[model samples]
Target: MKEVYINRISKYLPNHPISNDEMEGKLGIINGRASKGRRIVLRNNQIKTRYYAIDDHGNITHNNAQLTKEAIVGLCDDDFKAEDIELLSCGTSSPDQILPSHAAMVHGFLKNGNIEINSPSGACCSGMNALKYGYLAVKAGQTKNAVCTGSERTSSWMMADTFEEELQYLQTLEDNPILAFNKDFLRWMLSDGAGAFLLESEPKGHLPLKIEWMEGYSYAHEVEACMYAGGDKLEDGFLKPWSEYPSDQWSKKSLFAMKQDVKLLGENILVKGVDSLKMALDKNNLKPEDIDYYLPHISSYYFKESLYKEMIAQGVEIPWENWFMNLSKVGNVGAGSIYIMLEELVHSGKLKKGDKILLSVPESARFAYAYALLTVC
Candidate 1:
């Protein structure tokens, strides 16, 4: 098998960063009322700013596909042309439409002529899947190069209009936002952005990241859904498909609203993630000291200590100095989070040759996780 290297990395954060105080103003308050959980959630999450693909009044400026196209364009320059891309793999938890796979829509916007494309849809692991697919293709010598993109355009779903219909039934909330804690908490957490990576059989650009290995695991069969959208949860912890609901009930029930069982997430997300991490480390014969930088796609800063403690319990503690995160700066972009982190570190002038970077992403939706090890060269 041939070696695969990430030749270039690019990111596109839409518009300007929205400050914490400006969140509800931009997303709009639900039914002209502010959320009671807003301050508490922001305090715990410790997010200062995040980007949204919308204006102050919540009008969409760029859809998911357009955000992805802009990121891919950033990977092209004098040495590479958009038309010359061989494979384009796009991954996203939030897409612009229901029909036509995400990659197809992105390619349509790119107008990069004909090219092979694939779209891997999941929560946080979608981007890892896209990257692994491209990595394997290049490693197998089936393709000389591939362009992989991860993006999220979830700001549209977080808007007040998306949940206005549900507010009609909120009699208990006299002056506060009407959304349930499950649905409303996500509004302050998610942001819009895209990240792209170029993979090739040989290294290019300064400090190309060599793909050492990729590992992934799913506990969906053993675990119930914890984070979800476009559906409602049943009494037995199963999700009722959005297709089964009447069209009129969609907005009324907020079927498409991004939601989370916060209690369930707190109980299982950390333990499951550490379990997957232990497996990957054992399989690869790696130890904590081997990782020079640890980039974790975490939703909140509150989890920083919890994750470290959980890893210690699992006997895989990487030191505090090894951890690198930008959640406070960029917010959570779901599947796009890991790609954005990787892109930032690739050009931060922090990694030296022989440095090892460990990446971990956990998706609470169905409990899927992915891990990868990269060596700076």
Candidate 2:
């Protein structure tokens, strides 16, 4: 098999990083009522600033496809250019549309020639899934180079307009105008951005990350979805997909708003993450000490200490200093988050040759997870 190396990496964060105090004005308040949970969620997430694709006047600046196109275009240079890309793999939870796939939409924006493309759909783990597709394709000599992207345009989805009707409906029926915690909590937590990586058979950039190994797992059989959108979970924990319901209820009940089972999330997320990491480390014959940097796609600081404690309890502890994270700086971009963190680290001038970096991404949307290892070259 041919060796795969991530020769070039780039990220595109639309517009400026919006500060905490300015979020409500930017996102607007549902029915002109300020969010009751914003302070608490931001305090817990520890995200002081995050980027959004919307401008000051509440107009969208970029959609998911445009964000992705910019990131892929960023990879072009004198050695290997975007014109040479042979495959495109994209991943996202918030796609611009239901059909045409995210990769097709992105390619439309690029105006690049037709090439093989794959769209992996899910939450945060989708990013690694996209990378794995490109890596395996290159390794198998199916393509000389591929551009894989992970991005989200969730800011618009979280806007007040999406929930005003639902909140008003609740007010008429239950005298509760407040948006449901499950639906509204995510607005304060999610931002928007895009990131892309170039996978090549040979290294070309100044410093390339050689693919050591990648592992993925899912606990869906053992548990139900903890985070979701475009559906409503029933009493028996069965997710009622959007198609099964009437189109009228979609907007009336805000059926498409992102929701979370906070209690369920707290119960299973960290524990399963440790278990997944434990199995992967053992199978890869790796010890905690062997990792020089740990880039985990942790969504919020609310889980930071608890996750560390969980890993230690499972005997797969990596010291605090070795943990490389930018959640507080970048916010949670869902599938785009892990790539965002890597882009920051690569440009931060911190990594040296021979450094071993481990990536762990766990999604509460059905408890799926992906782990990968890379060596700096």
Score each candidate by Cα lDDT. Answer: 0.91, 0.91
Alpha carbon RMSD to native, model 1: 1.5
Per candidate, the number of residue pairs that clash is: 0, 0
lDDT (10s digit) by residue, model 1, range 1-377: 99999989999999999999999888888877789899999999999999999976567899999999999999999899999899999999998888899999999999989888999988889999999999998899888899998899998899888888788755444644357899989998999999999999888789999999999999988989999998999999989989999998887799999999999999999999999999999999999999999999999998889999999999999999999888999999988899899888877889899999999999999898999999998
For model 2, give the RMSD to the true fold: 0.9
TM-score of 1: 0.97
Write down the worst ten-residue block by lDDT for model 2. 168-177
Whole-model lDDT, candidate 2? 0.91
Q: In angstroms, how far off is 79's CA in candidate 1?
A: 0.6
Clashes of 2: 0
lDDT (C-alpha) at residue 48 in model 1: 95
TM per prediction: 0.97, 0.98
